[model samples]
Target: MDLPVQQFRSEVEQGMLDSFAALQEALPGAQNEKVAKLRAKAIERYGSLGLPHRRIEAWKYTDLRNRLGEAFPMVRPSGGPIEQSEIEKALGPRIANMDAYRVVIAEGEFRSELSDVQALKKAGAELRSLAETLEHLPDDLEPLLAETGEQRSGFEAARPTGRSGAGPDPIIALNMALMSGGAVLRLGDGISLDKPVHVIHLDGSGEPVGSVTRLIVITGKGASLNLIESYAGLGGRGLQRNALTQLVAGADSHIEHTKIQREEDEAFHLSNWLLTLHENVRYDGFQYTNGGDLARNDVRVFFEGEGAVMNFSAASMLKDRQHSDTTMVVEHLVPHCTSRELYKAVLDDESRGVFQAKVIVARDAQKTDGKQMGQALLLSEGAEFDTKPELEIFADDVVCGHGATSGQIDDDLLFYLEARGIPEPQARALLVQAFVGEALEQIDHEPLRDALTGVTADWLGVKLD
Candidate 1:
């Protein structure tokens, strides 16, 4: 006799499927046939793949299926009342007063009253809410919503232990299936912004809730922009956030993208950055993560044209029982392109950190240069870190390499600092700051870098001189 096979589904996974079924008719872009089909396809794919787990190679280190116990109710657009002071408090000290064009998303909905729409419009930038854009349904929105099959196949092929039946990334699929409110920014050809455009995401709901947001940015040829994204919670617990941002850089365009994630201690955060670079484009990206109970950052970069340059850096600080994972994949599909990645993590208490990166160079991508490095600092004996760096080069004339390292604070250096006038705590803080400063220094913007440095200092509980 053969026993019947049964597939186990977690509470969170079943809740997500039920929520989608209940909210499908009321979701954004429900009236559009294209978006409807996209959402259907995404949910179907998600049902088959389920939540990513340790069984999946890419998600081996960070298992969402086991970590997320229950799925909170999906957040709706409430247009709730929120004060600018509350926003500042959520952003913390130094970054709250930065000078930039601000866009605020509270409780997963775009808050027009808090955004600097007029200023952005005056600066030759087109801004729209994802909900509004979906309602209107632009002709070019299909490509923005759907991930190409070729890209997924290429990623699977590049993996050492390829996924047998993985169709689309489950995280991305879930985000697309339930995406509601976010901002979309577009810049015209040759247009340049004098100030950065800051997008702030705040979770203010008192009870448990889940939010799905999507941001789309497109830059025209010769255009330049500096974009910053900030995520924080306003005294909320049990918050689940899944956010996706897609950026397309035109030929010869210069784009600087920075992200800071500092959610509440009880929150679960998942974020993805999908970047496409064209010919002669310069793209600089940085991420600072120091919050959330469990957080994962997934980034994928595609070089669609030759002569493109990309630099990506990240810094993560975790303490207590917090867990953070940063995964990146950079593909060079064209010749004469360059890519660099650097990530740093600081773990204290019983916290755990993970870093996984893979760089792939296509067969015809001659003269490609790619390098990746991940470093971790453990402050306590219980702290743990795992790092994996991989390089796949099919081109003969390519220079590609990867490295990873994890260690505790150097005792000699700490003792040397203590021998000076500095106390032990201050000396340790300084060392931690310097350890992460290498990754933070990649940001070219002074104010942004300084503000992020202040954040890092705050995380270390020391005031910077």
Candidate 2:
């Protein structure tokens, strides 16, 4: 007798199938041959692999196949054109007060009125809507549109994500299939952007919509740029923010990237960064998460040339059943490259936090230095934290090390703080703040660090001096 078998197709799988069909049929880029080809390949690849679960090693800590449900279709542009008043109201005073050129993506569409596109173009920066640029497939933007790195099953799962690494990423393919609106940014050779570029994604409409925003960033040799991005998930049930950022730093170029996530507790946020560094390039990046029911940030970096240096850090303060995951993969493909990774997580109530970091050094990558550390502080009995740090070295001259630690708040420190005339809650908050502040301090920008610290204080129910 034959036994009944269980099916693995979830609502997200089925919904994605329908969503791809809808995008192909109704989206504006339906007629663009390049977009059509990319979308078709993505759809076919996604159909082949499906969603990933804990069975995959890299995603073992945070299982999307089991936890992810309810996938929404491509979000159409809804509501009237956004006025300056609405943009101000959505960005709030903190982001608005920053000295930067703001590029706004509201409801999955690029809002030219709210952005400083013209000013950027006038200043010799190449700024174009991703959807618009893809229409013509300009020669300069060809590198970003093409795929890079080893074959993968999905993301860093199944295997790793470097030369001779893991399987393909379906989420990547999915974004390429239905990505709606984003920006392509390029800095003129030998020029530095006088002001930082603030790309803020704001979703205010209460619709079951998923925004697939893709950004392609290219910095010419000897140029520099400071990029700040955030996801403000303001409204809706089951709101999803799926974003993909591909950045390339030319030789002798510098890039400082900062990200902050302060979404509503009911929203879902997923972000992926694929960045590469050329010879003598410098990259400094940091991320902080305070809100969102389910938040995952995946970053992959490759040092393709010699003399590249990178410092990446992140902090997560989760509370009230919130779940946050930070996964990072760094590959040293050349010689004389150095990378530093630091992550901190504070879990309160029933919240859960995950941090997975891996570093790889190729056989010929001599003088490579890579280090990573992850520390988690659990504030409640029900809170849980998982951390995995790995280092794969093929070069005998390479130096690489990793460490992970998870534990509850220190009673001794709590007592000492309480003895100093602070209340228990306030003392605990102070300790947690200090724990995460260490990671946040690595961010180069002072005001941005302060703004993120303010969010941390808000989560801890304490004020920062």
Candidate 3:
């Protein structure tokens, strides 16, 4: 069969082709053979599919070609200049008292001084940079990495679309072709770690830089762990970060994920997290996106065993010309599993935000209870919200529902507060915060939840009543 030829013209598609070809040339015969083979397959798939554009359903809300005007090469392995004091200075007050395990990546480069290997080892866990663990990464992970440019499948699934007549996503292909720094943490059976593990990804001033930080966390049966990811950077010039995380929970295990994305105003941030749950396991997550020019969080969860439960919640505050997006998908593959998701967006000035969520229940997955809701507060005439919430159930016995609302603050509530001797601006801010408070209440950690509320208050420039 002969394929059409014009499907290869867009600069985005051409850039991907050139980038992948260069990577293939740079990596010569059989050294890192598996990595090389995966790269080749990804390049072929991308070249045939193109870049993901507005026409693609999954990427309809966020367009990569429009955001990333150009492509950047993966910097060759060179340990460059990085400052430890700068990182310590930028640490937020929430984590100031955290004496827990730490691993830091500066300007896309790993820093040892900021990493706590001893603390990690003492907790019966293993921490190694991706470069050092290259010999140990499993082969199954390679397919997931390579097919990132293509659609995703499995117990949890979502079809990735290519550009307007072009084929798959090249940026994802670029990540697989050039990922150099990441980490893996594995917990022993029945072990519980009270101390949280923090992974920090930082960016600095330079020729607009780009990075892909990958992390794999596996908890043993009956084990429990708490994880905190801090995506921090001194709001600077144009910088881009593409990160991916995979979490696997054993039977009856508990996992908690907390993330802070406070990148600079000109930075471009994109993040994706995929999680798998076994029987009776529980997973909870919280995310705060208060910075960055354009940021998107894509989360996928698969409930493979009966009685598994998952919760995903997040809060985002946007101002200036900043743009933020949070998209999540949950799959119920087995009977008697449950999932609950709540996401809130507060947009001000000329900012824009997007929230797309979907729940999928398989044919045999009877009695699956799933619920999702998204609420947004528009603070300015220029602020915009694009929301799509859907539920696809293949079984009749399942109970699944979803809803989304995008509107301004309630005038009656605002008026009532103002009548109570509060200034109008302060009253409006109070109502917005109260609207978002319900999602924060679900957070189990006191300090983290309070920290997120503080950020929200600061963004609104109001003190809580």
Top model number, TM-score: 1
Per-residue lDDT of candidate 1, residues 309-343 (tens digit): 99999999999999999988788999999999999
* Alpha-carbon deviation at 180 in model 1, angstroms: 0.9
Q: In candidate 1, residue 110 scores what lDDT?
A: 86
Which sections of candidate 3 miss by over 4 Å? 1-6, 20-30, 75-85, 88-91, 96-99, 136-171
Candidate 2 to truth, TM: 0.92
For candidate 3, give the lDDT of residue 123.
Answer: 79
Error of 1 at 88 (Å): 1.1
Q: Residues 1-465, candidate 3: write the lDDT tens digits.
A: 222334544675576567556665543222567767776765665566555557677678788767778765554434555565566555566554454678877665556666887777787887767655555547655555554522222432333234321234455555566565777788888978877788888766556666766777888899998888888774476766878787889899998898888887777888878788999998898888988888988777878889998888988889988888887777788899989999898889998888888787888899999999898999899999888888878889988888988899888998899899999989988888898898888888777777777777877888875
Most accurate candidate by lDDT: 1
Residue pairs with clashing backbones, model 1? none
Indicate whether candidate 1 or candidate 3 has the larger lDDT: 1
The 10-residue segment with the lowest total lDDT in model 2: 148-157
Model 2, total clashes? 9
Relative to the unseen true structure, what is the C-alpha lDDT of residue 465 in candidate 3, on a scale of 0 to 100? 51
**Cα-based lDDT at residue 34, candidate 3:** 77
| Candidate achieving higher lDDT, 2 or 3 | 2
